[model samples]
Target: MSLPETMQLSLGPVLFYWTRERYADFYREAADWPVEIVYLGESVCSRRRDMKLDDWLGLGRELTQSGKQVVLSSQTLIESEADLRDLRRLCDNGEFRIEANDQSALQRLSAARLPFVAGAALNLYNPATIAVMARAGMQRWHAPVEMSRNDLARLLADCRSEGLDQPCEVFAHGHLPLAWSSRCFTARHHRKPKDRCQFVCRQHPEGLALRSQESKEVFTLNGIQTLSGACQDLRHEVSDMAGMGVGVARLSPRAEGMAGVVAAFDAARRGELSAPDPLALVEAEICDGYWHARPGMDNSRATTAP
Candidate 1:
């Protein structure tokens, strides 16, 4: 779909472990896709060192040269001085926008007078919090994964009343990022300690799915990050999001079929296709309950563009 330039289709950072070659190959392929903005980095576990600061910056430059707005994402959980050092380098890179996934990143960026994206992990639950970030030089903010459409509308309205007009980005697709821990669930599943786990996460490019004792899919484990067992497909809410004055719609990078995902969202935005049920594109069940302000795991109801 030929969407207006104001409405951007963005690609979020890869959240799982991948080989360096695979990571580079994915972005090379993405350069030709319909996405307008591309976020680059390892946002999950700091130990996934397949890509480093220089590598991320190099790729970010390449993507920027390819005519895509590139943003560097910080680690969601900072566990050590090394992590903070890496986060400092990302914020100081000065070549691309930085997506501050945690308060540490935000503090660095704010202190440096550098404009950044407030990533979903920053706990931006209300307009007042957003106003503080705006004052701290947040150019755009990604709404928390659990925030509903009405929640977003209300926040936007409240911010507008305060004359705070920072752009809002939504996590429109991908497994919902639920929580982060000091421990690695993936390693625990394999009976290995996080520091000595031998990089088992490389095997589960899409993440290791965890099921309940009842044999129901429950959650996905990617190193220290826990995600929704169901993939979030808000393709159906494109029109509603656009109407709500959303500036960017982010699609998280998966190991496979990302081209099709980008094409699907591009087409859906152009009115060429109904946002296909997100479930149709992946092996996991689809969920949009959080968009309706319901339980994050509830998929019993959804609302699409009229």
Candidate 2:
């Protein structure tokens, strides 16, 4: 089967610790956004309980009412009984689709015989892995960050040959979620233990900044997640992704100026995008090397400086 010319847009789960009011306002406003799918839930540290399951379900209902496919995402690192309980509840809801972010959640979800969306955190690198998960009932799979255009093309081909049905979604914008560890960087930075973080990450909604060994602005530190400092702008590759069988472009939420971010990506996908200083207003610098199969940090735009 051939892919469509226009790729769909999807807003990924909000990964920061925003206040209840801020969180409500953000999704409430997003209820009208033209994205095809919206994944909502606490995918980061669970201690940051700014919103509860009921609140998330309420927003999911609202978004679903607005005709958007809503997926409640499971936690990335489920280490607590409470987290596991929440995961069970989310998957058991039977009302909204769920995104499995970790192995534990995936195992439980599989055991329950419930189908779930494959969150990007899943290691779906090749055709064999993709086929394995597809057979296990992954209706849709999120493309990993470091996976490339060619790799995805082969996976798509294999999906077709193996009859592993699923829609492909790519991480288009937002800081690249590099890694998640059991240790909290925020607490480590302050010389505090993980058990007593004092919620330091809540202060920097986007995340704390980290410089490179060369003293260059490089990475951002979230509780236990290290992310690329650059806001990945793959709008330019919207058409390319679609050609390679990508159905949706997944955009991660940022603290400030999400409306503009959505609009810019929407416009770019339609090939009607034109803006002055588009790069300057970005909350972080831009990166697209992984999409182009180049080094993650080096900018293709910078190399061809003509």
Candidate 3:
């Protein structure tokens, strides 16, 4: 099948804690990457204040000047009044669009009548839910991480029947975010309370890997967010997603080798099958079972060299 000419690549927001300088350098280099869109801001935990709202807006402006579309993302878990205030500030930033990661963000943005990009954490499942979000001024949305390709195709078909045209973006690559908790898993791992974590998450930029009794990697602990142990690679399915009317492919940020990930996806979109395999550039095992309607950890398809 022919790839959709309009399908674009997006860099998802940074999900792990990093030093302020490291965050700045990442975006500075990402400006030259192949992605057309970039989501900025700390989306995982509220205690991660390395970069504040003004800092994020400043970075967004820089990226915008570099010819990339930037969207300010809201925190996924709103546990405090401080978090609410941050969300309000993000919604009123007046510069870049917002990516609503939770219900609070959606409410604030909708109340202000501003259009937003719905984050995957919103858990939008069917066309009926998407129609409601569309009416609430959602201009784009990320498919839930567990949504199968067949489910997405069916959802898109239903949206078309209802005349809902908001663009759908898939979490095409990176560690799949599985859950968020009020307690800080990283802090607990360090034998500290959530309030006294002392910012230990910074030590593990990619996240603390969790393993099962059999010593198999299972999940990753990043502050309050739980992520998949194996990186989810969907480069092989980009053409199928394009054919299903997906408008954007989102790659979650990793601590290293992001340039290769962007290049590999770009090559896939352009049908350059000879590009270097993105799987080779990452440290974790790769999986695509969720995309194929199987267990999330299963890699149903055999790996093929690109």
Candidate 4:
């Protein structure tokens, strides 16, 4: 399949807890990456205080000046009053747009009459649901990580039939955020309570790998967010997504080798068929089954770049 000429790459918000310096350094490097859009903010546990809204806004301004479209992302699980306050502040940020990761964010953005990005955690499954969100000021929507390509194509077709024109963004790369909980799994792993847990999530920048009883990799524990054990690489599906009217391909931030991942996807979109597979540069086991409408961890397709 030919590469899509207009398909653009995006940098999703950092789901893991990182030090303030590492966070700044990541965006500093990302500012020059080929991604056209960059989502900024702490969308995970609210205990992650390394980079607050001000710091994210500052980075957004820098990236915006560096020629990248910046979008502030809201937390996925709004558990407390503090989380709600942070969400309000993110919604009130006058400079850049926001990605509504939860219904609280959707309500805040909708009440303010602001156009926002509907995040994958929103669980929008059908054209009717997407149309409802579009009416509520959703300019773009992210397909849930578990959504199959066939389902996505059907949803897009239904949207077209209903005259809905909002752009669709797919989580094309990185560890798929599977679920979120009020309890901090990382803290529990350390035998510590959720409240007094000493910010240990920052220690595992790529998240703590969870293995099965037989010692096979199962999932990753990143504080409150549970992510896929294997990384998801959809470089081969860039053409397929483009054919289905997908406007953006999001690559979640990793602790290392992101520049190469960005370059690989960028090359694929530009018809650089000879580019190497991005999975080769990533540290985790790679899978693309969800894109092929199979189990999320299944990787039956070839891993080579298309």
Point to the candidate with the largest TM-score.
Answer: 3
Model 4 root mean square deviation, Cα atoms: 2.0
**Alpha carbon deviation, residue 86, candidate 2 (Å):** 2.2
Question: What does candidate 2's lDDT look like per residue over 1-306, in tens digits?
Answer: 323654789999987778888888998888887788899898988887768888899999888888998999988988888878887887888788789999987887888778888988887877788877877778888988988888888888878888776888899988899898889998899888988989888888898889889876598898988888777888767767877778889999988989888887777677666642335336577787888898776566655545
In candidate 2, which residue ranges exceed 4 Å CA deviation?
1-6, 275-281
Q: Give the poorly placed runs of model 1, Cα more than 4 Å off.
A: 1-4, 275-279, 300-306
Q: Where's the lowest-lDDT run of ten residues in candidate 3?
A: 273-282
The TM-score values for the models, in the order shown, are 0.95, 0.93, 0.96, 0.95
lDDT of each: 0.87, 0.82, 0.90, 0.89
**What is every candidate's alpha-carbon RMSD to the true fold?**
2.3, 2.5, 1.8, 2.0
CA deviation > 4 Å runs, candidate 3: 275-279, 302-306
Q: Write the per-residue lDDT of candidate 1 for residues 197-217, one digit (tens) a residue.
A: 999999999999899998777
lDDT of 3 at 211: 98
Of candidates 4 and 1, the better by TM-score: 4
The TM-score obtained by model 4 is 0.95
